[model samples]
Target: MIHIRFSDNNYGGEIDLSGTPGDLRSIRQSIIKLLQAQDVQVCIPANEVKPAPYDSCLNSLVIRKSDCSVKVMVAGSSLKIEGTPEKLKVFADWFNFGDSTESGYHNHFDYYEGNEWVDPASVSLIISCKYRGTK
Candidate 1:
């Protein structure tokens, strides 16, 4: 099960997401709903027509806010993502929906280590927002 824990000053909850390797419609909906409830903007940066090998899908994301933070935990490892509200949302979306039927974007393959894929059951995420003023 994909478990996502979301926390902010006004809201805090957890969601268990259901889906499979190639499809993640439900996961996308749940995450987008959570971001919308937080009033965080969702943005996708333009991708290069010819991306280089090893290029990051989110490499062009710009940081507009210093207080907002999002983190993901896979297995026992923790990853912290820093950016504006939109970038953070983009990262979150990609983390859950990348390469799946729900996403129009290409595979970030973030869940893969080298040539192997990580088990979805061991994937969990924590999204924490500390936005001040209008995001």
Candidate 2:
């Protein structure tokens, strides 16, 4: 069985994955997909838009990668995201959110509503998971 224990200042839990490689992969994919679904499409740099006009200026995202939120440390010009491998992919997909025309990117959840680059909208994501270990 795959065992994972987690803890944080407020909340935490343990997740156990038990199954074949393909089953584990499916589990991971499901987890990431669930997380992708939680994010709301916030207009970046909300100033350019007219209707909202900074009304819903959501410039930050609290990405709960796992049962326990991982710690992101920004030291100098470097940054660190520390957590389980499965959890990391959730954040990875969000950061790479964009359209196909945007080179070197994968469309995970299709968060980009197509033409968002020029239309001032948001909807984009990409996800992948490789199951490791035997449980």
Candidate 3:
């Protein structure tokens, strides 16, 4: 669950990405642009505030009938990717966010590792930002 509350009182919202691989992938691709931009803003009307359907079943299915190579999740302002070290390296290689020098805004990717349970390693790449919503 990612709860986004802006510094300004006018902006706030939440998105539950608990077990939705598809949503996670979609969101990852969408926000990849943030690595270059100085700031990106979003707006959601008060009338439109509602919950999306949960993906518990879908997530369970994907995790169950597959090799434990890679799993991705979105937590707040960070992206959590879990898998083997080799697999994680491969993912980092595949994350071609382009040359940062061209954009002038140097981007940084911070990784947090965990050992909640052995075998496939886990890492969380955190990108911190206050939500900016239009009033």
Candidate 4:
């Protein structure tokens, strides 16, 4: 299963996929594609804004990936977004947020004479976003 979390205080999400290796790879690729489609960027805070100010601004998205999972974080000042989980889900689904299905396999025995083993298949994603205030 995969889980995603988003917060204004520190925007981020977590993905948990404990299953086949193929599924994990597919999911990872899907997430990368999704972010690319949204044109996500890495936000850098300005150097003049005060800390804990109440306002709205456009920030960038920071994405980090590993073997098991991937994480997405966004940072900025006065970052307040209006949207609940349901709303976000709707938007994600509409944009093909998590959709992928491609599988393949390799056999070492084909070349190693008698070496054969199955590779582990699964992926997880954890994302977090931190806002920095200006001086």
Candidate models: Cα lDDT each: 0.31, 0.29, 0.29, 0.25
Q: After superposing candidate 3 on the true structure, give the runs of residues whose Cα lies further than 4 Å from its correct spot.
A: 1-67, 75-77, 100-135
- Tens digits of per-residue lDDT, candidate 4, 46-72, equal 222222232222232223222221112
In angstroms, the error of model 2 at 126 is: 26
Better of 1 and 4 by TM-score: 1
What are the per-residue Cα lDDT tens digits for candidate 2 across 61-127? 2223333333443222222223333545544433332222222222233222342221122122212
* Number of clashing residue pairs, candidate 1: 0
* Residue 91 lDDT (model 1): 53
Counted clashes in each candidate structure: 0, 8, 0, 12
The list of candidate 1 runs beyond 4 A from truth reads 1-18, 21-23, 38-66, 74-84, 95-135
Provide the RMSD of all predictions against the true structure, rounded to 1 decimal.
17.1, 18.3, 16.0, 17.4
**Candidate 1 residue-wise lDDT, 1-135, digit = tens:** 222222222222122222242234333454456456654332223222222221211212211222433332221111223334454456545545433233123343233344222223222332222111211
- Against the hidden reference, what TM-scores do the models get? 0.28, 0.23, 0.24, 0.20
TM-score, cand. 3: 0.24
Model 3 per-residue lDDT tens digits across residues 1-135 = 222121212212222222123323333443343323443322111122133232111111111112346554443333334444434434433323332222222222333356322233322222222122311
- Total backbone clashes of candidate 3, pairs 3 or more residues apart or in separate chains: 0
Quote the lDDT for 83 in model 3. 48
Alpha carbon lDDT at 126, candidate 2: 19
